[model samples]
Target: MSEWRGVAQGCAVIVGVLLAGLAGAGIWIAVYMQGDPQPDVAKAARSHTARAADLLVTAHVDQQLAQLRTALPWATHLGTTVADICETYPANTGFTRRTWTPVMCTRTGTAYLAFDGDFREHLAQLDTALAAEGWKPTNNAGDQPGLVADLDYTHRPPGDATAAELAEAAARPNVATVRYTLPIPSTFAVPPGAGGGPFPIGTVEVAQAPHLPTIDDGTAAHDLTLETRHFVDWQPYSHTQLSTAYPAHGAILAISVRLPYNT
Candidate 1:
């Protein structure tokens, strides 16, 4: 009888083990059927999140484009007006091919303006104009709304300085100065405010040869031809291409030449 009881107990133990195995199998099957067989819940969530973010960005971009379209006409008109007033070409004789748009200049273009003065006077005047106009210098991309000014100027020190010395001077910390060159509309001439000439019309750009790498050759062979242009489109006047090498950091020096009072 003891032997028979022991056999029965053994049988019961085997049955319990089998039942537990079956139960576990069933649970696993149920989980499998529920979904996510591969079980990459985190990845799926990330994909969905990425799609949603894309949609949001697309919507906002469309809205911004719409806004820009609405304001386009006024902006164009302003540009035309400025270009007309500050005709890129110097009003006075002797300036060739408009505001030194290109990097290199012929000997005549780069030559000193009379024995009495250099380019600093124009820079100072431009700086004054920018301040009066309430424009600030900047170096942002063109797509964004702002002005892009390209400026370059070089100072010839007393006596001959070695290339190393010149390079040092070029790299020295810049003393920020306001510089502007602009075309004043015909409307702003002949009053208490507008008397002498074309009132400053565009942004000001005051920078050295290295500062305007686009224009600066680093050769120091030629006289410094301060060549900078204001992208007076819709954007505020600023340094637009400091990041690019071919375009160079200070290629387009910026200045905010203010509009003279309209008579």
Candidate 2:
């Protein structure tokens, strides 16, 4: 009986030790979580940067296009010509000189002008203009000369707040602040051997947002954004036939100033 009693006491001690250890672990976890909370800076900055990039690109394109148009008025309307021919046989056409005669030739055309100018100089001017507007240029190594820029911006709430309050404020859509830097471009020149010509250009591209939120913000906002990057890419020197469907040049303009409220 004494042995059985000792065994029972040992089991009770083991159970007590386990319960105490579990309680201590729980307390440590709670303290750690409270001390090191997840940050909202990355999330807020991403949201703000995306919207700001869209707005800035739109404004930049509009201003640049206006400037280009004013400088080169002839670029507005270009013209192209097409020819049609009709053939007829003469009455005395027996293996003779007048066997076949040209009856009529018709020509049709349109006033759609192709882009022309000193493209390299124009690109330089655009780069200068973008620099004056607070955009920093990025260096890219390739055959074609290109212009890329980055802009950084930040925002904060109007009033003072504690860390906890600031964190909570960040959670609030209206109170939270954001900061980010995004790379953009003003113009791009298609590389040689692209088949379009020696100076094909890609101005702008508009498409849906490249990134979507993983978590729902309850706003159901679905909108598009512009991808100024890859406005032009290099084509290798080869004798391969060029695709006929590709555009020789492009000058698309898209602008959006509204901030992403629920992104």
Candidate 3:
């Protein structure tokens, strides 16, 4: 009986030792499966960078729109409408290939107010206003009948580096550059006798750098750019009887801002 008790105690000790070994092995395997941590750190860095870029771009866009609102109160109309007509045709062979051409026509109309008085004076006024805000005239085609001036401004955002770190890390390149045009007339050409032909249209454009740095390994960076046309007033006569009623004014703003990484 004593020998049997000894054998049972020994068996229990062996089982405990085996269980402990297995638990340790499991832990080691789990740690090994986790792989390198550097990739995760890089991913976090990219996410931070993208978020920073997006915030910078949004602020810049808002500033541009605000300036526009102040400088051109007459530009009350700002929106866009699109019309598409589709027709079907039989397939045909051409150049040893058979294909059917898509039958669709899309028309977009934008309207906005131009300066009511001397356009040149208005342009000068706008230039002065923008100049006060650090914008400069990159090109001036004011002599042209329809086009006026092109203004450009560069803006840099605060860097991620701490103040104690190298200033070079904090000194980033231009995060974004905005180019806007001041036109004497509208971008749209109203048909003869259109009710709203007298009003001028103006346009603004914005373009910014990508959210992430371009990689040499063939990865593409996400960028942002957009153009908007602000109209003076609506034109009801331009629409056909079957068409929907035109809004009170005609304008369109298309804005796109892209960020590269997930948070």
Per-residue lDDT tens digits for candidate 2, residues 1-263, read: 99999999999999999999999988976665444332332243245543454344335434534443354442432222111111122424343333322221111111122233443343344445434443332233233222311100112334676787666644432111111112334332222222322221112211112211121111121121222111111112111211211144332111111111111
Instruction: Encode model 1's per-residue lDDT on 1-263: one tens digit a residue.
Output: 99999999999999999999999988976665543222232232235443343244333323322333243221111111111011112322342222211111110000001111233444444334444444343434223223221222222333587888788656653323332233333322322423344433233223333453122211232223322212211222112323232222222232222332110
Candidate with more favorable, higher TM-score: 1 or 3: 3
The list of candidate 2 runs beyond 4 A from truth reads 34-121, 131-136, 142-250, 253-263
- CA lDDT, every prediction? 0.31, 0.30, 0.33
Residue-level lDDT of model 3, residues 70-127, one tens digit each, is 6666444332322211122324444333333322111222222222344335444554
Worst 10 residues of 3 by lDDT: 215-224
TM-score of each: 0.22, 0.27, 0.28
In order, how many clashes per candidate? 31, 6, 12
Ranking by lDDT: 3, 1, 2
Model 2 C-alpha RMSD to native: 30.5
On lDDT, the leading prediction is: 3
